[model samples]
Target: MKNNLDLTQFDFKKDLPDWQVDLITKTLSRNFVFKDFEAAFAFMTLCAAYAEKIDHHPDWSNSWNQVKVQLRTHSKNDITPLDIELAKAMDAFANQIQKPAEI
Candidate 1:
């Protein structure tokens, strides 16, 4: 995997405690579970708006009350700083809608 982001400064284990980064796939992933479908959709809607603003979208899907997310910088063909930033934003959004997402 290759990217321009400075990975050294990021302590992935602590920084994204709830996320999983797969080097084999070069993607950052997480599954977020909400109280209901509406809550799930609400989370997605918030993420969509933020993603649009940043011009970077996530590969995600919703099923009832769960949102499965995978983020990566496609152009770079690897997980980069953009993925990290987006994941952080997503976690924050999840917290705003409710208590927190279930891992």
Candidate 2:
């Protein structure tokens, strides 16, 4: 286990689902796509506000129409419940703001 794991708010093996644990426990990563840069940035802004509200920050990058995010507690060098919660929040925000592409 990484020394940075947030034992105060999570268990290394139990706070997240098995798949999420496997995917992001130590090296948290998720990708989100949107209709365009506008939508992608919108989602990022919303997520930024949420992160600020929670006093947690995520490592992220955005391109024209996609955003890649990684969440973890740097102090612990591992995923914590805060990471899980923020991931879910970002997912929900994306779902809420996602628009279908025009053909």
Candidate 3:
């Protein structure tokens, strides 16, 4: 087993605290609503950059005015610090894009 992690800077408690139990990757799911596909895609583009910058990617899908994102660290096979960092990063990027908190 890995060392216990600190959750100070991450919002895991609010959305995924229990995710720590399962050693198989954890998914942080959020649903974003927009006025149209254009707006939805725009938010996704920004998220893409944020994910790349942090070296953590997400599993996402878009439909009409809604976008769904699920974050997980595949290689670790568990919820590690990287997933926490990505959650924080996504929160910031979503806020910057005027997306309301849903996670």
Judging by lDDT against the true structure, name the best candidate: 1
**Could you tell me every candidate's TM-score relative to the true structure?**
0.88, 0.73, 0.67
Count clashing residue pairs in model 1.
0
Model 3 alpha-carbon drift over 4 Å, by segment: 1-11, 14-25, 99-103
Report the C-alpha lDDT of model 2 over 1-103, residue by residue, as the tens digit.
3334454555535633332444345755777888899999899999999999999998899999999887777886666667777877887888788856569
Least accurate 10 contiguous residues by lDDT in model 3 = 17-26
lDDT string for model 1 (1-103, tens) is 2347766556789989999888878889999999999999989999999999989999999999999999988888888877888899999999998875569
Best candidate (score: TM-score) = 1
Residue-by-residue lDDT tens digits, candidate 3, 1-103 = 1344543444556765433333333455677777788778877888788788878888789999888777666785556666766666666665666765479
Q: Which run of 10 residues does model 2 get worst, by summed lDDT?
A: 15-24
Whole-model alpha-carbon lDDT for candidate 3: 0.66
Question: Lowest summed lDDT over 10 consecutive residues: which window, candidate 1?
Answer: 1-10
Ranking by TM-score: 1, 2, 3
Model 1 misplacement above 4 A: 1-3, 100-103
Task: Compute the lDDT of residue 13 as modeled in candidate 2.
Answer: 50
Off by over 4 Å in 2: 1-25, 99-103
